[model samples]
Target chain A: MNNSKQGMTLIVKTVTRVTVWLIVLYGIYLILHGHLTPGGGFGGGVILALAFLNIMLAYGREATQKWLNLKFLEDIEAVSATLFLFMGLLGIALGGRFLINFLPKGSPHALLSAGNIPILNILIGVKVAMSLFLVVWVLAGLHEEKGGQS
Target chain B: MILPYYIAIPLLSAFLISLIAGKKDEWAVLLSTTAGASMLILSIYSLIAQNGETFVYKMGFWSLPIGIVLVQDGLTCLMLVLVSLISFTSLIYSVQYIRHMDRNWKYYALFMLLITGMNGVIITGDLFNLFVFMEIALFSAFALVAYGGHAEEYEAAFKYAVMGALSSALVLIGIAILYSATSTLTLAKIAEKVPTLDPGLIFWTGGLFLAGLGLKAAIMPFHAWLPDAHSSAPAPISSMLSGVLIKVLGIYTIIRLYFNVFNAPDFYMQVFLVLGAVSIILGGLLSIVQWDMKRLLAYSSISQVGYILVGLGIGTRLGILGAVFHLFSHAIFKSLLFYNAGAVEMALGTRDMRKMGSLARVLPITSATSLVGTLAISGIPPFNGFISKLIIIIALIKAGAPVYAILAVIGSILTLGAMMKMQRYGFRGETEIKKISEKIGWRMNTAMILLAVLCLLTGLMLLPGIRESIVDPVVKVLVDHSQYMQLVLGR
Candidate 1:
């Protein structure tokens, strides 16, 4: 209990929250601009998870549950993974081969370029985002349950 | 054509099961087991059909050197069959084994995910894609290993996660470097580009991939996280992790990358030879000191992997054949042994070998299966392990590596010693028998017996027709490295 005395100040909290939100928004921006720039789904998704992690740590698990529930996270993961697979399979069925860049290529170096690459990036971004969150949550839960029986 | 199904079936079932598994928890075992059986059959069929042929399922007809592809060659099919076989048995065993556990849906879901990752890793024709699949497998595995959430499991999972992530980062860097060098991600395309690339980049990328994947495989120098992770997981998971996960994630990918993607170097072979020798000796010596049954098995996996590396490192055709055979044999026997350990723990409520014994009097089936596993792993005559070990030793001697050959023999003896200790403490020691409430179920026994039977039959893989049908094509893929690129790219 004595350790609680070194808690964050209001200004610090507000600034931290703002920074975290910005980081999250920037991750989304990067993901959206994946096919255009160097950053793609993996980079953006990892940043998004960092934002989620910040939120989770700032608010307790119980408080966070109201907004970012485990079930919802799991659903997001499953759905996104399925969507990615479906997109790949669609390419296959269309005689393009699996994960082929079948969709029309937008202008190169544009936000919409690389045909289905951007869409794939988004799908992968969702999958990675949720997956990282789930992994962190699971790890955090494990840490909390340190005293329990195996 | 068969390449897609390897990834598709597992991916499909993982989703399907996750969707319905919550309500159908009781039947999840059956469903997963059925999937495992069908995948096993499919893998075998793929192997038989694709002998001497490389079947590539292009992601979107995006053309070679660009798009992702699922390529099935003889070796990939062999690894697939081994993975599927072990998965089927573990799924059956898990039915009874996980009866008292909570979160059954999550367990089955993660199990399905793990299988998908493994299947994807085996069939993937791209290097970066291999790393992705490896992550999928490792991520699910970390959660599964810590599924119990007990102190020891958590500690073990944390350690495993850190090590796994480090290895993954290294792998990602390796992929980046390889891409930078070759300007291609596809294995076939990279193989085509290897000679055209700068030698300096090849040297660096090769070292990165080796360090990264060697850690995953739990080869000697990089094998810190394995024992804790393998020993802490639930019994069936322990079985899967030791039996197939390390082989697929670490060993198979390393071989595929080395022989197919990059040209095998004399120095690389020499490095593997040295590491293999150390792992063989160290793993065996360490296992001899462990008191925990599963921990000992985990260490034994290191030793067995050492033997496999030795076989491959020898680089002779016989050496490669031996390594491939050992991979298959080790998967069967190790999984069977783990299943036996699980049964013992289930019945006795403890895994410490020091606790009670002469359990053979009570658990005849487990005792018998374990004996078969122990003997097979110890390289006793007439078993699958003997054939592979013999081939590896002969290959070592033939390759003018007598020192390694001698070390391999010592490793075999050490394995025998450790198994003997296991038998003495777990089976031969007398223990008080309380009235057993529940009968040792059929699912458990069936799984162990099936694996035991495979351990017995795997020796026949050396037979001429069998070798030609099953083993030779796999060996051919590794030996005829240049042909692999042509076959896959159809250039």
Candidate 2:
């Protein structure tokens, strides 16, 4: 019941501590298996972001800031988006159309089989995860600032 | 293949500018200006290279109907040129205009993203792709409208976002219906299959599309957000919104879907006529009562857009040609007017027409250029608006719609009255506030001057040689709806 610390109650934190990593791992699995599964870049990316949001909700702003700074998250978002665009352009530079699958298609079901799908998934996952974190960070900051001022 | 760069360059520059801008204003401006310039050049080159031919580039090496494709037809080329030109001018104008504002980088980034979205919408050969691009444009526009972060701006942006989202939902439902009925997301394939489907289903889908795109276009009853959104945003963004966004996101999509995809049913043509006439009458009447400079311009945009719609609704070859010409001319003069209004606000620190006086003596360049814009917009002789309006009226009568032609003429008279009111009160009257700064920045002046010149010369596009080279192909594409499917499918 002690609200002195910057987070929720002990039970929620304890539960989040166990579940967050599992959710993150599952997201990565979904992204890796995107070509063979129903989940792709966007679906897995949202899940990954949810994992971070769980940590933020359970441990609060200061702890999240320690783990990932807002400025660093913004940079990651921008860089990842730029990387996705660059990869698309790289397709054209390699004598194919933009966003074409230029790499070798190994096997259908394997993790690395889908040419460029996993790479794109990873890039989108990072971008989406960082973007959601930044949004939460800003909202939290605004709330704290208002609470302090009033 | 070359078509992808139209989208790629802006997307790349947008993210790169965000990454590198980091409070450095110069990088954002330079990168965005360069991107806009490159897009303009690329569009011109593509226009020349295609030379009335259609070029389709398939993404991921997938064949037509299976993969995403970018089709550069005459209509697409015309839209690309207009988008790039207006965006380029706005970026240049923003260099000076937005210098006083915070977060200049985000502005440039959003601006580039908007251009990317418009280019994607213009070139994409897929239905869902158009929807995706519309979202990109809408999101950026919503943000840009609220960029000032004032109370009124927030209110305007919230209203715009709600209306925009509702419209987008309608469009999605329509797309879903079309896809369910035809089992295809490719526009060309849908066009080929749409005629064979149940007329009732097609009518429902068409109605949904009209309501959705109509909201975005701000046609008559759906025009609640334009006055606030156009007037509250920063000046450069207002120009972009009025000059290109509605035309591209709203009118262009409506035309593409109705004419090409749906084969221009007579029922929809009648709908276009009614909506066009109502919007023209209401918008012009509303403008006469406004004292705010940008608000007047905003209402005027609605009226002018109605003219374009009327032309399109007439469904004659001359009518289509007039519509296309008026569209191009409107892009030039409306942006010019918005820029001039921005300059006036910059100098006088007020948008109220009653407070502005003797600006012609102090801000000579802006005043002069704005006069040209006013005359052009009023359909005065020798300017671009006159020729386009004449064509539309003549075409209307030729199509045996004398009533609509008369209504159009009435709209023109009201437009002239409103513009004369703006010119007289805002620039010609005796000096009201003597302490206000009279000087406008050089970049702002240059942009307005450039647009004014274009406004004067764009009428030349109606000439036989120029008409054949540019406007005729656009007319051809719209008139022969089957040509769209044939060109995209290479049949």
Candidate 3:
């Protein structure tokens, strides 16, 4: 019955509010530059998921729920996966083998240099991010339910 | 081009099922059934079209050795057919079976994903790719086994997950060791390099692979989790686990790696023979004591798998033939038996044999189909099991392993006694009047009946024409190791 006790203390919340956006921006950068940089979709996706987790940690379940709907997250995960598979099938449809890089490759280090690699990285990043978010949401929901009961 | 569809169709369907089904059970059923049926048709077409030749599909147009390639040969085609057939039947059965269960969409989604993983495992030509596909199939199976949310289901699933994770770790380590030794991840390249590897490293890598895959296949010493997991899972899943999953992920991988990639020495074959013999005796003896119908069938799977291993271990062309034939026959009859068990459970609401009896009067289709399955599995004459068992015994004699030949015969007798006991206790007594309905769903009945008919008819596959077209090429793939490398690597 103590509404004030929902999230962390004020100092942690303040720090988290400032840092989460920065972390998310970095994750997007990593995914966008995945082909040229060391970090790819999986690594960047985990970071993005962590950014969302930081919000949940600092702002409590209610705020996090409002910001990121679980159903929407699941939809994103499914759509991204289908998109990735479709991209692979595109090669087959285009008179090549499955998962073949069908697009023309530009020069290295350019924004759209690696053809399908960047597109695949973005799709995988979104899928992995949503999948991890869903997992954390479920586990946290279970913890909340158990806490309320006890 | 067609080879990739085996993996693509299942993967696409899994995502589509999840995306569209949301909370609708009917959509889930329709989507999954369509996926399963299409996969079955595709596999059959590929089997007929490819004949005995090997076809390799390079992913992303990357040439052989560097990019991931999907290889379709006689063995792969046979496995693809078996996986799709069993998956299709199980999906049909699940339409009615899981209707009442919550989150049926998730079940269908995981089932599709599991098929994707199995198909991928059957076709991939890369060592690391095999590990990835194995994990996909395994993770899905772990979830499916625990779908019921019962305490027993959770416990069994946890044990299965732990064992599966350990085995996967070992497999990864083996792959790492092999890669470090050979400097390549392609299976064909590894096979070419295996000849010059350090003896100690080869011994270590081979031991790791055998133990890891042995655990997956539930070979005797490493089979502790199978009974609990298989018995606790839903019946359709139990059928998948027993009929095709173990064969694809465990035995198929072992045969491919040992005979082709590693060219394992004679001592390893002896090890396989001994392990097979022990599992035969132990799995059979254990099944005879189980009162739970599903558990009895689960234990029997171990025993049947033992027969396949022993046949393969004999290391002759005929022996491999017998093993491949037995694998095919076991897939048919075992899934048939499991589906029958599921139907019985659906009608009677109890898996305990002692609780009800003489249901043959009410459940005529289930009883008749299960009778056929039981007869085939127990190696009665004119049934498929008998032909495969006979070939294996003959092969053992030809290979000059009379002691193993005798052990195999003894295993057959044990299997017969156990199955007969099951029939007597589960189906032959006075009918019990229960609150549950006696009429099972037509979909379940259709799946069981089709499998039962397949069980009876599969014996003709031993005829020279059928054998040469289907089973012989698989046998040759294993017996002649050089052919695998040559086919994949183009000499």
Candidate 4:
């Protein structure tokens, strides 16, 4: 019954709008508890990106661009990657070896037991989420660009 | 310590540039060049400070069976130095050269990743680690090839990616087979255990490597993608591809595995000889017919690499020395020539040699540098190419391979002819001056001049004192195959 020129029908949009927050929450859970479970940064990151992809498909690109610009996403990607690199460098400063695990390992099965691994997982998750978003969005929009390529 | 930085610095720069740099690309240029400069210094420092001593750095304090290791020996040092030097020049050249490409910071970012991959491949002592690093290098290379956003460029990049993916799969299979058979992923450990494996398994593993790495290296039969991919990239990138990338990804791994790990088996040596001779002659002949300036340079790279393979296939001390020296010299001269090609293309907006002429009047520096490059590639006297080629031919005669020596001379002649054709048509022609789309910038000129000077001076690497200190150590690594195992594994 939906007759919109852009974006999907009412049912698809409604389902996506309601489910987006839950998908993202699940992704955050995956990243935060990465050290304790099977799902880590990459697995969680793909799930997080899928949330955005769903939004893009349901609400159209122009609508998504209004709330989230590609440039901001890129900045997020860069910052997360830099932070990850900084963690590795900090390893050298603290332990005299590159990427050496200098942080204290807490008791087994605890949420924060694996020292810097959870921190790294969170960083990688954010970076991967941003990259997938950018790549997919750009490819989708590739056909619309005029001859500005030099 | 320095070995880690070789991988770390470039990866950090790539991330930082994307994070911090603005739309303008000035910071991108500054940061990349600084990174390149530091790497060059660090590589030189390691080479001199170690003075041929082997240094192995264990990752995260893990032992050989469990963790990755970075090993730096004479061969690694030579490659590290060569890579850093060419990359520094290419970065300088790209500062002004890539200005017209709209989003230039991304170019720098990808380029840094390419460097990181190459440095990783050079320093790593683990087998699977090498494959990982090779992928990093190849991925960036594919992106850079299609950077122009042209239809043909995309076509070329697609072809390269397909070939590269197939090669990677084959390499993975080879690594898997070796791992299953030997139960070790450390290269030195594999070398120690390989002699005891079933001969049939060894044959399959070696053949898989020969085919897989051979495709990456673009030997005689597997050379379809080199010309298109090399010619289609941005000029500085083309220089990087033809100059160091092929050697790093293809030739270096081949020699490292075949000689150091496989102990230069007789059958594989025969394959090297036949492929080397065929690529040399056929590549030279193909290059002579190319009307596109960069395309001809691409074909020429195949020929030059063929010479290196021939030297390696000869399987003697003098022959291996010739191979390493030629690899060194070829990196300098070929890059210089590609820079000249890039500069010419930048000015004219065309790569067709038929459309170029009288550039000597407008682009004096490019002309002068290109002449040096042409001479060096053609094996003329006083240039590094001549000495290296002479050594190879002499080694061939000494090794009692007179027929291959004859073919080598013919290949050299064909190279000379192709290079002269390039100079005559592209620089010295009487075609009236055409519209100049871009002016040759100072940075580009500086890069060309730097490489051109090195083309004449690198032959000094063979002098008595220098040879004792520099060249001998590298040759020693290849001559004594067990040295890699003993030095890296301490067995």
Best by lDDT: 4
Residue lDDT tens for model 4, B56-132? 89877787889889999898999999999999999999987888565569999999999999999999999999999
* Residues B1-491, model 1: lDDT tens digits: 55676776678677767655665476666667777888989877877787567777776566675567777778888898888888988888888777755556678878988998999898888888888899999999998999877888999999999999999999999999888776788888889988888887778888988888998999999999999999999989999999999999999988988877777877788888989999999999999999999999999999999999998898889999999999999999999999988888878778899985786667889989999999999999899999999999999999988999999999999999999999999877767555443456998999999988888898998888877988998999999888788888787
- Per-residue lDDT for A36-127 in model 3, tens only? 98999998999999999988888888877766778778888999999999998897888577777888899988988888999999999999
Give the runs in model 4 whose Cα sits over 4 Å from its true position.
A1-5, A146-150, B101-103, B432-435
Residue B198 lDDT, candidate 1, scale 0-100: 80
Docking quality of model 2: it rates as medium
Q: What is the Cα-based lDDT of residue B17 in candidate 4?
A: 93
Across residues B379-460, which tens digit of lDDT does each residue of candidate 2 receive?
9999999999999999999999999999999999999999999999998877754555646777788899899999988899
Which order, best to worst by lDDT?
4, 2, 3, 1
Using DockQ, give the best candidate's number: 3
A1-150 in candidate 4: lDDT tens per residue?
A: 124456988889888878999999999999888899999999899999999998899988887887687788888998998888888788878877677888899999998788889899999999989898888888888778763242
DockQ of predicted candidate 2? 0.59
Q: List the residue pairs that clash in candidate 4.
A: none
lDDT of 1 at A147: 68
- lDDT of all predictions: 0.85, 0.89, 0.88, 0.91
Off by over 4 Å in 2: A1-4, A139-150, B432-434
